[model samples]
Target: MDFEQGSINISDDVLKEIAFRSFIEVLAPDEKDVKKLKKSIEIERTPDDNVIVYVRTVAPYGQSLVEFGKKIMKNISENIQRMTELQVSAVNVTITDVVEKIETTEEEE
Candidate 1:
């Protein structure tokens, strides 16, 4: 897009940050675990100027990964498009690991 002044260009890092923040918002992972998710997001620009997003992360063992992935994709796509006005061709989510949700049991005093 162009204005009277000049054209606005959005950087890949900004795009990635938008997607990353969206992912974090939807996933709601533990604060400490957020670092683990930071490096897994990537943004690609297609020849046609469209965007493709790749996300890899771990999910809780009992959750439905397919549904979770779909949720992630939807959030990421919507966020990038809404924020940057970039056409998102796809948002691919890969579940890299599954960790069991730990349960804490209280001891009777």
Candidate 2:
């Protein structure tokens, strides 16, 4: 008797979802905000099974550097679990730029 099985592969949608969730969880933005935040957040996989995440957050940066790193790792772990078969060796997060925070006016507040 012979048994057949297939290996699991990570899909692009999963990667994008993971990236978006990670950003939202890390940033914790308010829903009523007028201006759009998070200019761009990208996730890419390297040939060596490494995940790279790039984030651009609105400034003045509220979250601490340490917290940011922790969130990235947490999100990666969660995503890996959801995917089941894909194993991530490491996750690297790079903050590309900081956008100025929008000042709230009296009426907006």
Candidate 3:
């Protein structure tokens, strides 16, 4: 937004936070997952002032990586654009690992 005096700028940290929160909302991650996510989200600002988001994460072993990546990309891009009113040049999702969903027995729960 622009005013007579100046314009409001969203910082890279804020953008990063939004991206992080957006990922959590989509994934509904657990405690262990949250820790991993904290280190995996990064924000890059382009010369033209657009933003690029890079996310490295683990996916469920049986899920399709392509569709999974697209899901994450869409969510991150929409969130950053909506919250900051800034263009997202790209949302690059790199699948770092694939883990199986561990199911606990009734007695262990």
Per lDDT, the best of the predicted structures is 1
lDDT (tens digit, per residue) of candidate 2 on 1-109: 1226755566656665666666566566666552343335555677865556564444335656667666766786567556544555556555544445533233323
How many backbone collisions does model 3 have?
0
C-alpha TM-scores of all predictions: 0.86, 0.54, 0.85
Model 3, stretches more than 4 Å misplaced? 102-109
For model 2, the stretches where C-alpha displacement exceeds 4 angstroms are 1-7, 32-39, 48-50, 59-63, 96-109
- Which candidate tops TM-score? 1
What is candidate 1's lDDT per residue for 3-97, written digit by digit as tens?
89999989999999999899988778767666666678889999978999998777778888899899999999999999989899999998767
Q: Report RMSD for candidate 2.
A: 6.8
Global lDDT of each candidate = 0.82, 0.55, 0.80
Which wins on TM-score, candidate 2 or candidate 3?
3
Sliding window of 10 residues with minimal summed lDDT for model 1 = 100-109
**Tens-digit lDDT string for candidate 3 (1-109):** 5879999988889999999888877667766556556567889999989999998777777889898889889999998898888999999997766768522222222
What is the lDDT, from 0 to 100, of the residue 54 in candidate 2? Answer: 60
Structure candidate 1, residue pairs in collision: none
